[model samples]
Target: MTVRIVTDSSCDLSADDIERHRITVVPLTIRFGDREFVDGRDLPAERFYEMMANSDRLPSTAAPAPGAFETAFRELAAGGADAIVCVNLSFALSATGESAQAAARSLTGEVDVRVVDSGKVSAGLGLMVKAAATAAEGGHSATEIETQLAELKDRVLIYGVLDTLENLKKGGRIGAAQALLGSALSIKPCLDLTSGTVQEAGKQRTRGKARAWLAKKATEVGELEHLAVAHGAADDIDSFVAGLGDTPARHPTTVTLIGPVVGTHAGPGVIALAMVPAT
Candidate 1:
C-alpha cells in the first residue's frame, strides 16, 4: 500500500521541499485585527513580517478547521494513497494536532491516518516531517515510519531569543513581575521548547550576547545532523551564523525568514536555532 505524509503550516517546510517530497500541507490562519489570512497562501513569510512591522495590532494565529485537513486527506487518498501520517506542531502550543485527528476519523477505511504531535515547532517540527517523508519515499510501512519519527523527534532542540518582552507580555506569556525585571536590566530572554511548552533557558543584555549564548548551547548538546537558523525581519543572519564558529562546518545549516504566525509572538529581531542529533 502506498503511504503519504501530511503536515501543517507550522512545520515551516519550504515550498520546494514540499513539492519535491510530494508532501501535503494544510495552512493555519492568521489574524491581524479584523482581517484574517491563511498562513502560507495569503501571507508569504516576507510579506507577513512586513505587515507585522507596520500594523497597529499584533498578529495572532489559529489552527485550521477540521474541514481543511479533511479536504487535503481526501485529495491525497483519491490519488492512490492507502495511508497517511499527519504530523503537526506541538499540542501544547496549538490545536492543530486535535484538528488533524478529528479529520482522520472521517476518512474511508481504505486510508489509515495517524496523527503525531511533534512536541516542537517551526524547523524543529520540519525536521521530523522531512524525515517521515523520506522514510515513506523509501517504501517504509506506516508503522515503521511512525516509529522512526517518534524516536528522532526527542533529539531535536530549538532555542530562540526574543528582542522585546513587550510581545511576550502582549501574548500573555509573562507576568508583570517578569516583564518588569526584564526591563530593569535590558535583559533579552532565551527560550526553548523542551516537551511542548516554551520555557526560559537563559538571558543576555544584547543581541550579540544572545547569539553567542545560543551558539554555545547548540554545540554542547551533541553532534548535529541538521541545523537551521530562523529569524524575524530585523535579525542579521550573517552575524548570527558567523558567531557559531566551526559549528556550521560540522553540520550544514539552512536559514529561513520567520513567518507571521511565529513572529507575532516572538516579535522582531527574533533568532531561533534548530538542531537535531546525529543518528
Candidate 2:
C-alpha cells in the first residue's frame, strides 16, 4: 500500500520541505484575546510576531477540528494513497493528537489511517514528520513507518531559553517550573521539552547566559541524526546558532520559527535547539 504522511503546523516543517515530500499540514488556531487566527494561514508568522510585540495580552492556541483531518485523509485516499500515517504534536501538551485519532476512527475500513504522537513539539516533532514522509515516499508501509517513529521518539532532544515567563503563566501552561519564573524580576529561564511538556532544565541569571547554555545542548548531544534551531523574534539567532558549532555539517539541520502554537506559551524572544541522536 502506498503510504502518505500528515502532520499539524506545530511540527514547524518548512514550506519547501512540505511541498517536496507532499506532506499535509493541519494548522492549529492562535487567539489574541477576542481575535482568533488560523496558525500560519490567517496569521502569517511575520504578522503574528509583530502583533505579539505590539500587544499587551498573551495569545492562546486551539487544536484543529476533527473535520480538518477527515478531509485530508479522504483526499489522500482518493488520490490513490492506500494508507496514511498521521503524526501529531504531543498529546500531553495539546489535544491535536486526539483530534487526529478521532478522525482516523471515523474512516474505519475505507482507508488505513494510523495516527502517531511524537511526544514533541516544534522542530523536534517536525523531524519525525519529515522522516516519516521521506520513508513513505521511499515506499515504506504505514506500519513500518509507525514502528520506526516509536523508537525514534525517545532519541529526540529539545531545549529552549525563554526570555520571559509572562506568556507561560498567561497561557496557564506553566506547571511545576512556575516557581522559578513566576516573578517579574529579570530572569532568563532555560527549558527543555520533557515528557511532552515544557519543563525547567536549567536557570541563568541573564539572557546571554541562558542562550549560551542552549547552544551547549547541541554539543552535548553526541552522534546526531537531526538538529535544528527554533526561535521567536530573537534578534541574536545568528550568533546563537553559530555557537552550536559544526553539528549542522555532520547532520541535517534547520532553523525553524517557533510558530504561534508554541509561541503563545513560549512568548517572544525565545530561542530553542532540538537534536536527535542517529538511530
Candidate 3:
C-alpha cells in the first residue's frame, strides 16, 4: 500500500517542493476584518503582506476545519493508499492538529491515519513535514515515518526577533505594560517556542545585537541539524546568514518567506531561526 503524507499551511513549504514530493497541503484561514482568505490559496504571501500594510486591523488566522482534512484523507485513501500521516502546527499554537486528529478518528478502521503535533510552527514544522515526506518517498511505512517525525519534533528549535511589539499588542499576545516597556527601550525581544506557545528567550537593544544573541544561543544549543531563516517583508537574509557563518555548516539550511499567517502575528521585519539537532 502506498503511504501518503499531508500537512497544513503552517508548514511553510514552497509550491515546487510540495508538488515534487507529492505532499498534500491543507490551508488555514486568514480573516482580515470582514474579508476572509485561505492561506497560500486566496491569500498568497506577497498579496497578504500588502493587505496587512494597508489595514489597521490585525489579521486573524484559524485552523482548517476538520472537513478539510477529511476531504484530503478520503482522496488519498480512495487512490489505494494504505496509510496516511497528517502533520500540523503545534496543538498549543493552533487547532489544526486537533482538527486533523478528529478527522482521522472519523475515518476509523477504513484507513490508518496518524496525526502528529509538530510542537513547532512555520518552517520549523515545515522541516518536520518535509522529512516525513522524504521518509515516505523512500517507501517507509506510516508508523516508521511517524516515529522518525516524533524524534525530529523534539529536536526542533525556533527563535524569532520581531521588529515591533505593535503586532503582538494588536494580536492580544502582549499586555499594555509590556508593550510600553518594550517600545520605550527599543527592546528587540528574542522569542522561542517552549511547551508550544511563543515565549521570551531573551532580548537585545538593536537588530545587530539581536542577531548576535540568536547566533550565540544557537551555538550553545549544539547539534544543529536543519537550519531555517524566515523573514517578513523586510529582507535580512544576508545578515542573518552571515550571522550564522560557520554554525550553519553544522546543518543544512533553508531560507523562506514568513507568510501572512505568521507575519500577521509577528509583524514586519520579523526574523526567525529554526534549528534541528544533528544526529
Candidate number with greatest TM-score: 2
Candidate 1, residue 81: lDDT: 88
lDDT tens per residue, model 1, 1-279 = 688999998877789989999999999988989999998898998888788778888878888899999999989889988889999988877888999989998885757998998998888888889999999999998999889988887888888887876666677644323634446348878888656677777878887888788888778876778888888876577877777767633457887777667777778888888888676
User: Which structure among the candidates has the greatest lDDT?
Assistant: 2
TM-score of each: 0.93, 0.96, 0.92
Question: What TM-score does structure 2 among the candidates reach?
Answer: 0.96
Q: What is the C-alpha lDDT of each candidate?
A: 0.82, 0.86, 0.82
Clashing residue pairs, candidate 2? none
- lDDT-wise, the better of 1 and 2 is 2
lDDT tens readout by residue for model 3, 204-253? 88888887887786788776767787888766767777767677436467
Which of candidates 1 and 3 reaches a greater TM-score?
1
**lDDT winner between candidates 2 and 3:** 2
Model 2 lowest lDDT segment of ten = 243-252
lDDT of 2 by residue, 1-279 (tens): 799999999988888999999999989999888999998888988788999998988788999999999999999999999999999998888899999999999999899999998999888899899889988988899999999899888888888889888888878777667767655366788887846887878788888899888877777767787788889988988888777667643565789888888888888889987788765
